[model samples]
Target: MPDRITLTGLRVFGRHGVFEHEKRDGQEFVVDIVAWLDLAPAAASDDLTQTLHYGELAQLAADIVGGEPYDLIESVAGRIADEVLKDSRLSAVEVTVHKPSAPIPLNFADVAVTVHRGRA
Candidate 1:
Protein backbone atom coordinates (compact mmCIF):
# COMPACT_ATOMS: atom_id res chain seq x y z
CA MET A 1 0.00 0.00 0.00
CA PRO A 2 1.33 3.39 -0.98
CA ASP A 3 -1.01 5.55 1.05
CA ARG A 4 -1.20 5.75 4.83
CA ILE A 5 -3.37 6.98 7.68
CA THR A 6 -1.49 8.55 10.55
CA LEU A 7 -2.60 9.20 14.11
CA THR A 8 -0.22 11.00 16.45
CA GLY A 9 -0.01 12.11 20.06
CA LEU A 10 -2.78 9.92 21.40
CA ARG A 11 -2.32 10.08 25.17
CA VAL A 12 -3.71 7.84 27.88
CA PHE A 13 -3.03 6.85 31.49
CA GLY A 14 -1.70 3.36 32.22
CA ARG A 15 -0.01 1.30 34.89
CA HIS A 16 2.75 -0.31 32.84
CA GLY A 17 6.16 -0.67 34.34
CA VAL A 18 8.52 -2.99 36.15
CA PHE A 19 8.71 -0.88 39.29
CA GLU A 20 6.20 -1.57 42.07
CA HIS A 21 5.32 2.08 42.54
CA GLU A 22 4.82 2.48 38.79
CA LYS A 23 2.32 -0.35 38.80
CA ARG A 24 0.59 1.10 41.85
CA ASP A 25 0.49 4.64 40.48
CA GLY A 26 -0.19 4.87 36.79
CA GLN A 27 1.42 7.39 34.46
CA GLU A 28 0.69 8.99 31.11
CA PHE A 29 1.43 7.21 27.86
CA VAL A 30 1.58 8.62 24.37
CA VAL A 31 1.01 6.62 21.20
CA ASP A 32 1.54 7.32 17.54
CA ILE A 33 0.25 5.06 14.77
CA VAL A 34 0.57 4.85 11.04
CA ALA A 35 -1.49 2.40 9.01
CA TRP A 36 -0.68 1.43 5.45
CA LEU A 37 -3.52 0.75 2.98
CA ASP A 38 -4.59 1.28 -0.58
CA LEU A 39 -6.32 4.65 -0.57
CA ALA A 40 -7.24 4.66 -4.24
CA PRO A 41 -10.31 2.52 -3.78
CA ALA A 42 -11.78 4.80 -1.18
CA ALA A 43 -10.77 7.94 -3.03
CA ALA A 44 -12.26 6.75 -6.31
CA SER A 45 -15.44 5.45 -4.76
CA ASP A 46 -15.76 8.27 -2.25
CA ASP A 47 -16.95 5.76 0.32
CA LEU A 48 -16.05 5.55 3.98
CA THR A 49 -16.28 1.78 4.01
CA GLN A 50 -13.48 1.44 1.52
CA THR A 51 -10.90 2.95 3.87
CA LEU A 52 -9.71 2.65 7.44
CA HIS A 53 -11.49 4.92 9.87
CA TYR A 54 -8.86 6.63 12.04
CA GLY A 55 -11.35 7.63 14.74
CA GLU A 56 -11.99 4.02 15.58
CA LEU A 57 -8.27 3.34 15.57
CA ALA A 58 -7.64 6.17 18.03
CA GLN A 59 -10.29 4.85 20.40
CA LEU A 60 -8.92 1.34 20.16
CA ALA A 61 -5.38 2.54 20.91
CA ALA A 62 -6.61 4.44 23.94
CA ASP A 63 -8.45 1.39 25.20
CA ILE A 64 -5.42 -0.85 24.84
CA VAL A 65 -3.10 1.60 26.59
CA GLY A 66 -5.48 2.18 29.50
CA GLY A 67 -6.53 -1.45 29.89
CA GLU A 68 -3.51 -3.63 30.57
CA PRO A 69 -0.36 -3.47 32.68
CA TYR A 70 2.76 -4.46 30.75
CA ASP A 71 6.31 -4.22 32.00
CA LEU A 72 7.73 -3.17 28.66
CA ILE A 73 6.76 -0.62 26.06
CA GLU A 74 7.61 -3.27 23.48
CA SER A 75 4.62 -5.24 24.66
CA VAL A 76 2.44 -2.18 24.38
CA ALA A 77 3.57 -1.49 20.84
CA GLY A 78 3.09 -5.11 19.84
CA ARG A 79 -0.45 -5.17 21.18
CA ILE A 80 -1.32 -2.01 19.34
CA ALA A 81 0.13 -3.37 16.12
CA ASP A 82 -1.94 -6.50 16.49
CA GLU A 83 -5.10 -4.47 16.92
CA VAL A 84 -4.31 -2.23 13.97
CA LEU A 85 -3.71 -5.23 11.73
CA LYS A 86 -7.09 -6.73 12.59
CA ASP A 87 -8.54 -4.78 9.68
CA SER A 88 -7.66 -6.60 6.49
CA ARG A 89 -7.69 -3.36 4.58
CA LEU A 90 -4.55 -2.27 6.40
CA SER A 91 -1.53 -4.01 4.91
CA ALA A 92 0.83 -2.75 7.62
CA VAL A 93 1.05 -0.74 10.80
CA GLU A 94 3.77 1.20 12.59
CA VAL A 95 3.22 1.83 16.29
CA THR A 96 5.25 4.01 18.66
CA VAL A 97 4.64 3.89 22.41
CA HIS A 98 6.11 6.67 24.52
CA LYS A 99 6.58 6.67 28.27
CA PRO A 100 7.44 10.14 29.46
CA SER A 101 7.10 9.44 33.15
CA ALA A 102 9.22 6.31 33.14
CA PRO A 103 11.18 5.34 36.23
CA ILE A 104 14.46 6.79 35.15
CA PRO A 105 16.91 8.68 37.32
CA LEU A 106 18.40 10.67 34.46
CA ASN A 107 16.79 13.76 33.00
CA PHE A 108 15.77 12.69 29.50
CA ALA A 109 13.21 13.96 27.09
CA ASP A 110 11.23 10.72 26.72
CA VAL A 111 11.41 6.94 26.39
CA ALA A 112 9.72 5.11 23.56
CA VAL A 113 9.52 1.89 21.60
CA THR A 114 8.48 1.68 17.98
CA VAL A 115 7.44 -1.49 16.15
CA HIS A 116 6.18 -2.43 12.69
CA ARG A 117 3.86 -5.33 11.88
CA GLY A 118 2.16 -6.33 8.66
CA ARG A 119 1.11 -8.95 6.13
CA ALA A 120 2.79 -7.38 3.16
Candidate 2:
Protein backbone atom coordinates (compact mmCIF):
# COMPACT_ATOMS: atom_id res chain seq x y z
CA MET A 1 0.00 0.00 0.00
CA PRO A 2 1.01 3.68 -0.32
CA ASP A 3 1.08 4.17 3.45
CA ARG A 4 3.54 1.63 4.76
CA ILE A 5 6.56 1.92 7.02
CA THR A 6 9.23 -0.76 7.19
CA LEU A 7 11.94 -1.35 9.74
CA THR A 8 14.54 -3.89 8.69
CA GLY A 9 17.65 -5.63 9.94
CA LEU A 10 16.79 -5.46 13.62
CA ARG A 11 18.90 -8.02 15.45
CA VAL A 12 18.57 -9.57 18.87
CA PHE A 13 19.75 -12.53 20.93
CA GLY A 14 17.32 -15.16 22.18
CA ARG A 15 16.84 -18.83 22.92
CA HIS A 16 14.57 -20.58 20.46
CA GLY A 17 14.93 -24.05 19.06
CA VAL A 18 13.48 -27.54 18.83
CA PHE A 19 16.45 -29.03 20.58
CA GLU A 20 17.28 -28.58 24.22
CA HIS A 21 20.94 -27.82 23.55
CA GLU A 22 20.17 -25.10 21.09
CA LYS A 23 17.51 -23.76 23.37
CA ARG A 24 19.87 -23.50 26.30
CA ASP A 25 22.78 -22.27 24.19
CA GLY A 26 20.72 -19.43 22.66
CA GLN A 27 21.26 -17.75 19.28
CA GLU A 28 21.18 -14.48 17.44
CA PHE A 29 18.02 -13.38 15.69
CA VAL A 30 17.45 -10.71 13.07
CA VAL A 31 14.07 -9.11 12.60
CA ASP A 32 12.62 -7.29 9.63
CA ILE A 33 9.27 -5.61 10.25
CA VAL A 34 6.87 -3.92 7.89
CA ALA A 35 4.01 -1.84 9.23
CA TRP A 36 1.28 -0.38 7.05
CA LEU A 37 -0.73 2.58 8.30
CA ASP A 38 -2.18 5.87 7.18
CA LEU A 39 0.51 8.44 7.80
CA ALA A 40 -1.21 11.60 6.59
CA PRO A 41 -0.54 13.53 9.78
CA ALA A 42 3.02 12.35 10.26
CA ALA A 43 3.71 13.03 6.61
CA ALA A 44 2.23 16.51 6.65
CA SER A 45 3.43 17.78 10.02
CA ASP A 46 6.56 15.59 10.35
CA ASP A 47 5.72 14.95 13.98
CA LEU A 48 6.78 11.74 15.72
CA THR A 49 3.53 11.66 17.66
CA GLN A 50 1.32 10.80 14.70
CA THR A 51 3.32 7.80 13.49
CA LEU A 52 4.37 4.50 14.96
CA HIS A 53 7.52 4.83 17.02
CA TYR A 54 9.93 2.40 15.35
CA GLY A 55 12.22 2.31 18.37
CA GLU A 56 9.35 1.26 20.59
CA LEU A 57 8.26 -1.34 18.11
CA ALA A 58 11.73 -2.78 18.00
CA GLN A 59 11.89 -2.95 21.76
CA LEU A 60 8.54 -4.66 21.92
CA ALA A 61 9.54 -7.16 19.28
CA ALA A 62 12.81 -7.90 20.98
CA ASP A 63 11.16 -8.16 24.33
CA ILE A 64 8.57 -10.56 23.03
CA VAL A 65 10.88 -12.84 21.13
CA GLY A 66 13.81 -12.61 23.50
CA GLY A 67 11.85 -12.77 26.70
CA GLU A 68 10.28 -16.14 25.98
CA PRO A 69 11.63 -19.45 24.79
CA TYR A 70 9.57 -21.04 22.08
CA ASP A 71 10.15 -24.32 20.30
CA LEU A 72 9.53 -22.79 16.92
CA ILE A 73 10.60 -19.57 15.29
CA GLU A 74 7.28 -19.57 13.50
CA SER A 75 5.55 -19.01 16.82
CA VAL A 76 7.86 -16.14 17.61
CA ALA A 77 7.33 -14.57 14.23
CA GLY A 78 3.58 -14.99 14.36
CA ARG A 79 3.35 -13.42 17.80
CA ILE A 80 5.30 -10.42 16.57
CA ALA A 81 3.01 -9.99 13.60
CA ASP A 82 -0.05 -10.09 15.83
CA GLU A 83 1.46 -7.73 18.39
CA VAL A 84 2.37 -5.17 15.74
CA LEU A 85 -1.08 -5.35 14.26
CA LYS A 86 -2.65 -4.78 17.69
CA ASP A 87 -2.17 -1.07 17.15
CA SER A 88 -5.45 0.33 15.96
CA ARG A 89 -3.68 2.71 13.61
CA LEU A 90 -1.78 -0.05 11.87
CA SER A 91 -3.65 -1.88 9.15
CA ALA A 92 -1.08 -4.56 8.44
CA VAL A 93 2.17 -5.95 9.74
CA GLU A 94 4.80 -8.43 8.56
CA VAL A 95 7.33 -9.95 10.88
CA THR A 96 10.45 -12.01 10.22
CA VAL A 97 12.80 -13.75 12.62
CA HIS A 98 16.19 -14.99 11.47
CA LYS A 99 18.25 -17.52 13.34
CA PRO A 100 21.86 -17.22 12.19
CA SER A 101 23.31 -20.19 14.00
CA ALA A 102 20.98 -23.11 13.68
CA PRO A 103 21.91 -26.65 14.60
CA ILE A 104 22.07 -27.91 11.06
CA PRO A 105 25.43 -29.39 10.16
CA LEU A 106 25.51 -27.84 6.74
CA ASN A 107 26.62 -24.23 6.75
CA PHE A 108 23.98 -21.65 6.07
CA ALA A 109 23.78 -17.94 6.53
CA ASP A 110 20.59 -18.15 8.60
CA VAL A 111 17.19 -19.73 9.10
CA ALA A 112 14.15 -17.49 9.30
CA VAL A 113 10.42 -17.45 9.94
CA THR A 114 8.08 -14.87 8.44
CA VAL A 115 4.44 -14.03 9.16
CA HIS A 116 1.84 -11.48 8.12
CA ARG A 117 -1.30 -10.40 9.93
CA GLY A 118 -3.97 -7.75 9.51
CA ARG A 119 -6.27 -5.77 11.71
CA ALA A 120 -9.57 -7.41 12.58
Candidate 3:
Protein backbone atom coordinates (compact mmCIF):
# COMPACT_ATOMS: atom_id res chain seq x y z
CA MET A 1 0.00 0.00 0.00
CA PRO A 2 1.18 3.51 -0.75
CA ASP A 3 1.85 5.96 2.04
CA ARG A 4 -1.03 8.24 2.88
CA ILE A 5 -1.62 11.70 4.30
CA THR A 6 -4.87 12.19 6.17
CA LEU A 7 -6.78 15.36 7.03
CA THR A 8 -9.81 15.10 9.21
CA GLY A 9 -12.52 17.19 10.87
CA LEU A 10 -12.17 20.20 8.60
CA ARG A 11 -15.21 22.35 9.23
CA VAL A 12 -16.64 24.88 6.83
CA PHE A 13 -19.95 26.65 6.34
CA GLY A 14 -21.85 25.82 3.16
CA ARG A 15 -25.22 26.35 1.60
CA HIS A 16 -25.79 22.86 0.32
CA GLY A 17 -28.96 20.82 0.52
CA VAL A 18 -32.25 20.02 -1.18
CA PHE A 19 -34.28 22.44 0.90
CA GLU A 20 -34.75 26.16 0.31
CA HIS A 21 -34.04 26.97 3.93
CA GLU A 22 -30.81 25.01 3.77
CA LYS A 23 -29.68 27.09 0.84
CA ARG A 24 -30.66 30.35 2.46
CA ASP A 25 -29.19 29.50 5.84
CA GLY A 26 -25.87 27.78 5.61
CA GLN A 27 -24.64 25.10 7.99
CA GLU A 28 -21.38 23.52 8.97
CA PHE A 29 -19.88 20.75 6.89
CA VAL A 30 -17.09 18.50 8.01
CA VAL A 31 -14.64 17.01 5.53
CA ASP A 32 -12.07 14.26 5.78
CA ILE A 33 -9.54 13.35 3.12
CA VAL A 34 -6.91 10.70 2.61
CA ALA A 35 -4.38 11.08 -0.19
CA TRP A 36 -2.21 8.18 -1.23
CA LEU A 37 1.22 8.82 -2.74
CA ASP A 38 4.82 7.81 -2.58
CA LEU A 39 6.50 9.39 0.42
CA ALA A 40 9.98 7.97 -0.09
CA PRO A 41 11.30 11.03 -1.87
CA ALA A 42 10.29 13.39 0.88
CA ALA A 43 11.54 11.04 3.55
CA ALA A 44 14.92 10.78 1.83
CA SER A 45 15.47 14.42 1.02
CA ASP A 46 13.44 16.04 3.81
CA ASP A 47 12.06 18.48 1.28
CA LEU A 48 8.52 19.86 1.35
CA THR A 49 8.41 19.83 -2.46
CA GLN A 50 8.48 16.04 -2.63
CA THR A 51 5.19 15.55 -0.81
CA LEU A 52 1.63 16.86 -0.69
CA HIS A 53 1.18 19.91 1.51
CA TYR A 54 -1.84 19.06 3.67
CA GLY A 55 -2.47 22.71 4.41
CA GLU A 56 -3.11 23.31 0.73
CA LEU A 57 -5.26 20.23 0.60
CA ALA A 58 -7.39 21.51 3.50
CA GLN A 59 -7.73 24.88 1.79
CA LEU A 60 -8.79 23.24 -1.44
CA ALA A 61 -11.52 21.29 0.35
CA ALA A 62 -12.65 24.35 2.26
CA ASP A 63 -12.92 26.31 -0.98
CA ILE A 64 -15.13 23.73 -2.61
CA VAL A 65 -17.41 23.27 0.38
CA GLY A 66 -17.74 26.99 0.91
CA GLY A 67 -17.87 28.08 -2.75
CA GLU A 68 -20.85 26.34 -4.38
CA PRO A 69 -24.13 24.75 -3.43
CA TYR A 70 -24.71 21.13 -4.40
CA ASP A 71 -27.93 19.33 -3.60
CA LEU A 72 -26.23 16.03 -3.09
CA ILE A 73 -23.32 15.24 -0.87
CA GLU A 74 -22.19 12.76 -3.52
CA SER A 75 -21.45 15.62 -5.91
CA VAL A 76 -19.52 17.39 -3.21
CA ALA A 77 -17.46 14.30 -2.54
CA GLY A 78 -16.82 13.75 -6.24
CA ARG A 79 -15.72 17.33 -6.77
CA ILE A 80 -13.33 17.18 -3.86
CA ALA A 81 -11.86 13.91 -5.11
CA ASP A 82 -11.44 15.34 -8.58
CA GLU A 83 -9.67 18.42 -7.33
CA VAL A 84 -7.36 16.54 -4.98
CA LEU A 85 -6.40 14.15 -7.77
CA LYS A 86 -5.01 17.10 -9.74
CA ASP A 87 -1.79 16.58 -7.84
CA SER A 88 0.33 14.27 -9.98
CA ARG A 89 2.01 12.70 -7.02
CA LEU A 90 -1.25 11.33 -5.65
CA SER A 91 -2.13 7.92 -7.01
CA ALA A 92 -5.49 7.80 -5.26
CA VAL A 93 -7.68 9.76 -2.89
CA GLU A 94 -10.61 9.15 -0.56
CA VAL A 95 -12.91 11.99 0.44
CA THR A 96 -15.73 12.07 2.95
CA VAL A 97 -18.19 14.96 3.31
CA HIS A 98 -20.23 15.21 6.47
CA LYS A 99 -23.49 17.06 6.84
CA PRO A 100 -24.46 17.21 10.47
CA SER A 101 -27.51 19.39 10.01
CA ALA A 102 -29.38 17.52 7.31
CA PRO A 103 -33.09 18.08 6.84
CA ILE A 104 -34.24 14.79 8.23
CA PRO A 105 -37.34 14.77 10.29
CA LEU A 106 -36.08 12.06 12.59
CA ASN A 107 -33.24 12.72 14.98
CA PHE A 108 -29.91 11.74 13.50
CA ALA A 109 -26.29 12.18 14.35
CA ASP A 110 -24.87 12.94 10.92
CA VAL A 111 -25.05 12.31 7.20
CA ALA A 112 -22.04 11.81 5.01
CA VAL A 113 -20.86 10.66 1.60
CA THR A 114 -17.55 9.04 0.82
CA VAL A 115 -15.89 8.74 -2.56
CA HIS A 116 -12.72 6.99 -3.64
CA ARG A 117 -10.88 7.92 -6.82
CA GLY A 118 -7.75 6.80 -8.54
CA ARG A 119 -5.76 8.01 -11.52
CA ALA A 120 -7.14 6.71 -14.77
Q: Estimate TM-scores for all models.
A: 0.95, 0.94, 0.97
Candidates arranged by lDDT, highest first: 3, 1, 2
Candidate 1 vs. true structure, TM-score = 0.95
**Which stretches of model 1 miss by more than 4 angstroms?**
none
TM-score between model 2 and native: 0.94
Whole-model lDDT per candidate: 0.93, 0.89, 0.96
* Residues 14-103, model 3: lDDT tens digits: 999888998899899999999999999999999999999999999999999998999888999999999999999999999999999898
Who wins the lDDT comparison? 3
Please provide, for model 2 over 6-49, each residue's C-alpha lDDT reduced to its tens digit, 9 standing for 90 to 100: 88898888998899986788988899999999999898999999
Give lDDT: candidate 3, residue 34: 98
Q: Compare the candidates by TM-score and give the number of the best one.
A: 3
Candidate 3 clashing pairs, residues 3+ apart or interchain: none
Point out where model 3 deviates above 4 Å. none
Q: Provide the global lDDT of candidate 1 against the true structure.
A: 0.93
Worst 10-residue lDDT window for candidate 2 reads 1-10
In model 1, pairs of residues that clash are none
Q: Judge candidate 2 at residue 91 and give its lDDT.
A: 88
